[model samples]
Target: MTESTEPVKINKWDGAAAKNAIDDAIREVLTGDLKCKESFALIDGRLFLCALAVGVALYALLWDYLYPFPQSRLVLIICVSSYFVLMGILTLYTTFKEKGIFVVAKEKVGNVTRVWEASSYVKKHDDKYNLVLVLREPSGKTREASINKTFANYIDSNGTIVQNLVASEVTKLYNSLSSEKKEK
Candidate 1:
C-alpha cells in the first residue's frame, strides 16, 4: 500500500494501538531490506565454507605437531568445533548489527525535522513496552530515559500512527515548556 503524506490523527489511537504501530514500523525498518531469505542463506553458506577450510588446516597443523587429540578423531573434532565457532561469531555479529540498525531507525522515526526537543522509540520486553526517550536540550546535550508502559491488544501496520504520536507528544511538550516560560 502507498504511504500517506498526511499525518495520522493521534486522538483516535489508544495506547496499545500506538505501541503496536511503532513496533511494526521498527520491524519494517529492521528487515525491509535484502528482499528475500536467499541473501541470508547465501551469507551463512559462504561463512560455513570458510570456517570448514580454516578448521581443516588448523586441525592438520595441530595433529602434525602438538597432536592435541587422537588422529582418528581429527575430522569429527574439527567439524564440531568449526560449527560452534561459526555460530558464536555469527550470533555476536548479528546482534550488534541489528542493534545499530534499530537505533538508527528509532532516531529516524522519532525526530521530526529536529523540531522536537528530543526523539523516542518503543522497545518491547516480555509483555511490556519500554519507551526510550532521548532528550536533547538547547545546550547541545542529550539524555536518555527508558520508561516502562503497559499496552494491550492493538495493531497498526503503517508507521504513520507512531510517527504522528511522537510528533504530537513533542508538540505538547514544547507547548507546555513555552507556557511555563511565559508564566515565569
Candidate 2:
C-alpha cells in the first residue's frame, strides 16, 4: 500500500504575542499626526474666504437697496453684519477644535517638544474615526477616540486620508511611542 500525505491547516494566531503585534501596528497607522496643523490652517483660511465672500454678496445687495429705504438699509446692514460675525465665530471655533492647543509637553526623547494639539482619524472594527495627535516634536500619536461625525478634511498633507489607522496599526504606533520613550 502507498502512504498518503495529508495537508495541514495553519492558523497564525495561537497566542497573545500575535495579537499584541497586530494591535501595535494598528496604533501607529491610526495615530500619526504629521498633517493636522497644515490641514487645519488650510481649512481656516478657506472658511475666512467663504465668510468674506458671503459678506461681500450681502453688502453689494444692501448697497443697491439702501438708498430706497435708509432705515431698512440700516436694518439690512445690521443683519448682514450679524451673519458675518456668526460665520467668523464658527470658523474660529472649527480651527481651534481641529488644530488643537499647545502647552508644555513630552516627546519621544523624554525632552519636551512643542507638541501641537491635533487629532487623527482612524477606522476600526467598523468605520470609525480615531484621534491622532502630533507632538511638539511633531511626531504622530494615536489616542482612543472618535472625532465628531462632522469631521471634514481639506487638502490633506502627506496625502494621507487620515482615516482610522486600524486596531493593529495603532498597536504598532503605541509600540513606537514606547520605544521612543525608552530611548530618552
Candidate 3:
C-alpha cells in the first residue's frame, strides 16, 4: 500500500472574514461563556477615596497659610483645581478605554482559567488570525495569540464568516480541567 504524499491544504482566513471571526469569537466568549461585564465601580470608588483623602489632607495643612498670604491661597486653589480636573479627565478616559471586550474563563472551583481583554485585531498570518490581547492576570500583561481559523463556522448576514474560535478554545480548556480533576 502506498501512503498519500500530498500535504493537507489549509484555508486562509483574511480581511473582513478574519475580522468578523475574531470579533464573533471575542463576543461569544465574553458574552456567553465568560459572562464578563464591564465595570467601572472599583476604579470609580478608588478614585473617589483618593480624592477625598487628598482634599482632607490639603485642607488641614493649608488652612494655616491661607490667611497669611492671600495670593498663596489663590495659587493653592488653582493647583488643587487643576489636579482635580486632570484626575477627572483621566478617570473618564480610563472608563472609556476599558469598555472593550473582556473574556474570563474560570476553573471548576472558580479559579481563574484565563483573563484577557481584546484590544484590537493585529493581522492574519497563514491559516491563523492574530489579535492584540491584554492579559489582566499576572499584572496586566499584553500578548498576541494566533487563532486558528478552522473553528469558525457561522456566516453572518453581511456575507462574512463569524467564528467563535476563542469560545471553542475556552471550552477545550474547561474540558481539560475537568479531565484533570477526574484523573486526580
In the range 113-183, model 1's lDDT, one tens digit per residue, is 11122223344444355544333344465555444544332223432454444334334444554355347
Q: lDDT order of candidates, best first?
A: 3, 1, 2
Worst 10 residues of 1 by lDDT: 30-39
> Which one wins on lDDT?
3
The TM-scores, one per candidate, come to: 0.34, 0.29, 0.34
For residues 1-184, could you state the per-residue lDDT of candidate 2 as single tens digits? 0133222122322222323332233333333432111224535665776777587667757665765665567666776777777677676765765443211123333353433333444334332334453433445543332233311231123222223334334344445554564587
lDDT of 1 at 161: 50
Candidate-wise lDDT, in order: 0.43, 0.41, 0.48
In model 1, where do residues sit more than 4 Å from their true spots?
5-21, 26-76, 93-127, 133-143, 152-163, 166-184
- Model 2 misplaced stretches (Cα beyond 4 Å): 1-76, 95-132, 135-165
